[model samples]
Target: MSIELLTLCLILSVFLVFVTGLPVAFSLGSVSMLFTIFLWGPHSLQLITHAALGSMTSFMLVAIPLFILMGNILERSGLAETLFKMVYLWMGPVKGGLAIGTVVICTAMAAMVGVIGAGIVTMGVIALPSMLRRGYNKELAMGAIMAGGALGALIPPSVAMILYSSLGKLSIGKMFLGGIIPGLILSFLYMAFIWIKCYLNPSAGPALSSEETVTWRQKFAALRDSILPMALIVLVLGSIFIGAATPTEASAVGAFGAFLTTVFYRKFSWRMLKEACFRTLKLFSMVMWILIGASCFSRFYMAMGAADLVKGLVTGSGINPWLIIIGMQISLIVLGMLMEDYAIIMIAAPIYIPIVTALGFDPLWFGILFIINMQIAVLTPPYGFALFYMKGLSNEITMAQLYRSIIPFVPLQAVGLVLVMIFPKIALWLPGLMFE
Candidate 1:
C-alpha cells in the first residue's frame, strides 16, 4: 500500500477507537501494535517494547511525579484554603474582591503546583460557595475559578510543559521561565476583567458589608498563616531561577517543603501521607502509560513515512510560515476538544516541531503558545476537563451554566496567545535574561 493510504487508515482507526470510548492509552497502543504486526512482522514487536522502555527511563520525567506528589501533599494539607482565606481577607474591601482574590490565589497555587485539578477542585469547593453566598454573579464567580485554576498548566513546575519540553527536545528550564510572563499576563487579564465588570455593574460583585469586615489585627493574623506557604513557593521557583537546582532537583525540594509545611500547620498525619502517595501513583501511572502508548504510535508513524509526507507538503506549499503556525494553533484548539493535553502533545509535537524548526521559528516560543491554547481547551464546553470538574463539585450548577461561564475568558486567553506569538520576547525574554 502507498504510505499516504497507510497513514489514513491508521489515523481513522485510532479516531474510531477513541470515539468508541476506549481509554486513550489503550487506543493508541492497540492501533500501533496492529500496524506494527501487519507492516513489520510479529518479530518487530520489540519496537514497541523499546519505545516504552525509552520513554519510561527518561531522567527529566522524574520531575512529573514528584511535582504531582508535592501538589497532592499541599492540597491534602489545607494550603489552598489558607491561601484563599489570606487573599480574600486582604482584597475583600475592593469591588469584586472575592473574584479578584480567587484569581490571585490561583496564580499562587499555580506557582506551587503545576496541575489544574487540585487548584480547581480546591477553589471550587472553597471559593465558589463563598462568592455565591456574597451575592456575586454565578457566571463571573465560576469563570474566575475555572480560568484561574487552569493557570497551573501555564505556570512553572508545569507537568504539561515538562512533557512538551522533553518530547520537543527544548530546554525544560527555558520552557519553565518562558511560561512565567505569559501566565502572569493572562492572570492579570482575568483580574482586570473582574475588576472592570464589577465596577460597571455593582450587582455582579458587591463590596462586603461593614459587619463582614475584619479588623487590621485580624488581617495580620491571616497574613501570618500564609507566610510559610508563600515562602515555600519562593524556595522552589527561586531555586530554579537562580541556577541553584535543576528542574528535577527543584521538584524534590518542593515535595519535601510541602510536607514540612503540613507539619508546621499541624495538618500532617500518617493517613495524609499515604493518601498523597497513592494519588501520586495513580496520576503518575496514567501519565506514563499515555507517554508509552504515544511513543509507540509515533514510532510507527515515522516507520510509515507520515512525517516525511507532512514535511514535503509543508515545505513545498510555499505558504507563509506564519500562516502555517496559525493553522497549527487552530488545529490544536479543535483537537483539544476531543483529547487530553498529553495525547494532543504526543501526537502533534512530533509532526509539528520539525515543521516549526524548518521554518526557522523558535521551538520554545511555539511551545509556550501551545501551552496557552491548552489552558483555553480545558475551559471550553462539552468536553473541557475544567468544566466537568466544576460540575462535579457543585450539583446546583448545570453543565450549560458551566459552559456559559467560561465563554468570556476564552478571548482573554487568545489575546495572551497572540501577544506571545506577535512578540516572541514575551516568552523568550525571561529565559534569555536568566540563562543567556
Candidate 2:
C-alpha cells in the first residue's frame, strides 16, 4: 500500500475505535497491534513489547508520579484555601477582585503543584461558591477558575512539559525555564481581562460588601499562611534552575516538602498519605499506558515512512514555514476538542518536532507553543477536559454554560500562543539566559 493510504487507514481506525468509547491507551495499542500484524505479520508484534519497556524504563518519567503525589497532598492540605484567603483579603475590595485573585492563586498553585486538575478542581470548589455568593457573573467566575487553573500546564514543574521534553529529547530544565515568562504573561492577561470586564460592567463583579471586608491585621495574617508554599515552590524550581538537582530529584524534594506542608498545617494523617499515594498511582498508570500505546503506534507509523512523507510534503510544497506552523497549531486546536492533551502530545510530537527543527526553528520554542495550545485545548468546548472538570464540581452548571464560560478565555489563550510565536524571545529568552 502507498504511505498515504497507510496513514489514512491508521488515522481512521484510531478514530473509529475512539468512537466506540474505549480508553485512549487501549484504542491506540489495539490499532497499532492490528496494523503490525497485517503489514509485517505476527512476528513483528514483538516491537510492542520493546516500546512498552522503553516507556517504562525512562528515567525522566519518574518525575510524573512524584509530581502527581505532591499535587494530591497539597490539594488536600488546605494550602489552596489559605492562598485564596490571602488573595481575597488583599484583592476582594476591588472590582472583579475575587476573579483576579482566583487567577493569582491559580498561578501560585500552578508553581507549587504543576498539574491542571488539581488547580481547576481546588479553585472550583474553594473559589467558585464564594464568587457566586458575592453575585459575580457566572461566566466570569467560571471562566476565571478554568483559565487560571489551566496555567498549571504551562508553569514551571509542569507534568506536560516533562512529558514533552522526554519525548522530544529536549532539556527538561530549559523547558521549565522557557515556560516561566509565557505562563506569567497568560496569567497577567487573565487578570487584566477580569479587571477590564468588571470595570466596564461594575455589576458583573462588584467589590466585597462592607460587612465582608477584613482589617489590615487579618489581611496580613492571611499573607503569612502563603509563605510555606511559596518557599516550597522556590526550593523545587530553584533547585532545578541552579543545578542543585535534576527534575526527578526535585520532584522527590517537592513530594517531601508537600508532606511537611501537610504536617505543618496539621492536616497530615495516615489516611491522607495513603490517599495521595493511591491517587498518584492511578494518574501515573494512566499516563504510562498512554505513553506505551503512543510509542508503539508512532513507532509503526514511522516505520511506514509517515515522518519522511510528511517532511517531504511540507518541504516540497514551498509554503511559508510560518504559515505551516500556524496551520499545525490550528490542527492541534481541532484535535484538542476531540482528544486528551496527553494523547495529542504522544501522537503529534514525534511527527511535528522533527519538521519544526528542520525548518530552522528552535524545537524548544515550538514545544512551548504546543503546550500553550494544549492549555487552550483543555478549555475548549464539547470535549474539553477542563470543562468536564468544572462540570463535575457542581451539577448546577450545565454543559452549555460551561462551554460559554470558556469563550472569552479561549481567545486569550490563542492570543498568548500568537505572542510567543511572533516574538520567540518571549519563550526563548529565559531558557537561553539560563541554559546557554
Candidate 3:
C-alpha cells in the first residue's frame, strides 16, 4: 500500500482505539505499534524505542516534573490557603467578593504552580465552601472556581505551555512570557463576568456584610502575606525572561523558592514533603506516559508521511491560510467538547502543528491561540474535565447548573482566543522584547 493509505489506516486505527476506551497513552502507542509491526515488519519496533528515548530524555521535559513538583509542594504546604485568606480579606465584601477572590487566588496559584489540578482542587476545597456559604448562586460559585483554575494552564510556568512548546518546537521562554499577558486577560475576563453577572442579578452573588470587610489597617497588614508570594513569582518568572536561567533551571529555582516560602511560613514538614513528592511523581508519570505514546504515534505517522500529507492537502485545496487557521480552531473546539485537553494536545497537535507552520504561521502565536482554545474547552459540555472537576467538589451542583454557569464564560474564553488570533503581538511581543 501507498504511504497515504498507511497513514489513513493508522489514524483510523487510533480513533478506533480511542473509541474503545483504552487509556490514552496505550491507545496511541498500541495502535502505532500494531501498525508498525504488522505492516512494516518487526524492525519497526526500533522506531518506537528511539521515539520513546528521545521524548523521555528531553531536557525541556525535565521542567515538567520539577514544575509539577513545585505546584504540588505549594498546594500541600498550606501556603496557597494563606495566600487566599490574604486575598479574601482584601477583595471580599465587594459584590461577588468570594468569586473575585477565587480568581485572584487561582492566578497567584498559577504563578506558583503551573498545573490546573492544583488550582482546581485547591480552590474547590478552600474557595468553594466559602462561596456556597455566602449564598452565592451555585453555578456562579462553581463557575468561578472552575474558570479561574483553568488559568493555571495558560499562565507562566504553565505545564500546559511547557507541553505546547515541546510539541510546537517554539521557545519555552517566549511561550511562557507570551502566556502571561493573555493569562491575566483571561483572569480579568472571569472577574468582569463575575462583576457584570452579580451587578445585574444581585441575588445570584450576594455581597458580604460591612463587618466582613477588612478595615484599611487590616488590609495593610494582610498585604505582608501577599508580598512574599508575589515576589517569589516575579523573581522566578523574571529570571527566565531576563535570560538568567533556562526554563528547566527556572523550574529548579521555582521549586526551591516554593520550599523556602513554605519554610518561611513555618508550614513545611516531613508529611508535606512526602505528599508533595508522591503527587508530583503521579502527575509526572501520567504526562510522561502520554508523551511516550504521542512520540511513538507521531513517529509512526511521520514515517508514513502524514505530516506532508496534511500540508499538501491544506495548501493544494486552495484555501486561504487564515481561513484554514480558523478551520483548525473550529476543529479544536469540536474536539474539546469531546476529548480531554491532554488527549487533544498529544494526538491532534502533532498533526496540526506541521500544517500550521507549513502555512507560514508563527507557532508561538498559534500556541497562545491553542492555549486560549483549551481555556474554553475546559468549559465545554459533555466531557470538559474542568466541569467534572467542579461538580465533584460541589455536591449541590447539577450537571445542567454547571453547564449553564459556564455559558457566559465560554464566550469570554472564545473572545480571548480571537484576541490572540488577531493580535499576534499579545503572544509574540513580550517574547520578542525578551529575545532582542
Candidate 4:
C-alpha cells in the first residue's frame, strides 16, 4: 500500500481502539506496530524500537517524569486539601465563595502539578462534596469543579507546556513563562464570573451563615498555612520565567520543595512517597508512550509530506487564520467530548501545530490557546472527563445535572478563550519579557 494509504489505515485502527475502550498507549502502540510491519515488512519492528528509545532518551522529555512526580507528590501530600481549606475558610462563607475558592485552588494546583487528572480528580474528591453539602447549586458546584480542574493545562509548569516545548523545539522556559499570564487571566475570569453569579442570584451560590464565617484573625492565621505552598509555586515558576532554571530543573526544585514541605508537615511517610513514585512512573510512562508513538508517527507523516500537505491546505484555502484557529478550537471541543483530552492532543497537535505555525503564530501562544480550549472541552457536555469525575464524586449529582451544571462556567471559559485570542499578549507577554 502507499504510505498515505497505510497512514490512513493506521489512523482508523487507532480510532477504533479508542472507541473500543483500549488504553491510549496500547491503541497507538498496537496500531503503529501493526502498520509498521505491514508497510516496511519485517524491518518495521526496528522503527518502533528506535523511536521508543529516542522518545524516552530525549532530554526534553525528561521533564515529563519529574513533572509527573511533582504532581503525584503534591497530591499525596494533601496540597489540594490544604489549598482548598486555606481558600475555603475565607471564600467559603461568601456566596459562591466555595466555588471561587475551588477555582483558586485549582489554579494554584495546576501551577504546582501541571496534570489534568491531578487537578480535576483532586478537587472533585476534596471540594465537590463540601460544595454539594452546603446547598450550593449542583450545576454551579460541578461546573466550577470541572472547569477549575482543567485550568492546570493552560497555566505555567503545565504538562501541556512541557509537551509543547518538547514537540515544537521551543524553550520550555519560554513556554512556561508564556502560559503564566494567560492561565491567570482565564482563572481570574472564571472566578470573577463565579463571584458575580453568586452575588446576583445568591441562590446559585448562597453565602455561609454568620456562624460559618471565619474571623479576621482566623483568616490571617489560615493564610499562614498557605505561605509554604505559595512560596513553592513562586519559586518554581519564578525561577523559570527569571531564567534561573529550565522547566526540568524547576520541576526538580518543585519536587524537592514539595517533599520537604510534606516532611515538615509530617505528611511524608514512606508509603506515600513510594506510591507517589509509582504513580509518577505510571503516568509518565503513559504520556511517553504516546509521545514516542507520535514521534514515530510524525516520521511517517514527514515522509509522506504531511506537513507540506497541511501547509498547502491551509495557505491555499481562502479561510482566514483566525477563523481556522476558531475552527480548531471547535473541533477540540467536539473531540474532547469523544476522546480523552490527552489523546485528543496526541491526535490533533501534530497536524494542527504545523498548520498554526504556518499561519505565522507563535507555537507557545498556540499552546496556551490550545490548552484553554482543552479546559473548555473537559467541562463541555456529554463526554467531558471532569463532568464524569464530578459525577462520581457526588452520588446525589446526576449526569444530566452535571451536564446542566457547566452552563455558566462554559460561557465564562469561552470568554477567557476569546480574551486570550483577542489579546495574544495575555499568552505572549510574559514569555517575551522573559526572553528579552
Candidate 2 local lDDT, residue 429: 99
Better of 1 and 2 by lDDT: 2
Which runs of model 1 end up more than 4 angstroms from their true locations?
Answer: none
Give the per-residue lDDT digits (tens) of candidate 2, residues 1-436: 8988889999999999999999998999999999999999999998887888888999999998988888889888778899999999999999999999999999998987778888999999999999999999999999999999999999988989998998899999999999999999999999999999999999989999998859999998999988998899999999999889999999999999999999998989998899889888888888899999999988888888877898888789999999989999999999999998999999899889988987889999999999999998899866789998999988899987888889889999999999999999999999888877
Cα lDDT over the full model 3:
0.85
Off by over 4 Å in 4: 1-10
Candidate 3 lDDT by residue in tens digits, 1-436: 8777877787688789888899889999998898889877998799999999999889999998888888888899887777777777777777887898888899888888888878988898988888888888878888888888889889988888888889878889999989988989889988998999889998878887766656788877778877877888888889999999999998998889888988998889999999999999988898889989999998888887786688779879998899989998999999889877877888777888888888898888888888878777877988788888877875777888888888878888888888888888888888888899
Q: Single out the weakest 10-residue window by summed lDDT for candidate 3.
A: 206-215
Give each model a TM-score. 0.98, 0.98, 0.97, 0.92
| lDDT (Cα atoms) of all candidates against the true structure | 0.91, 0.92, 0.85, 0.79
> Highest lDDT among the candidates is held by which one?
2
Order of all candidates by lDDT, from best down to worst? 2, 1, 3, 4
- In candidate 4, what are the lDDT values of residues 372-421, reduced to their tens digit? 87888777767777777776765777777876778777788788888888
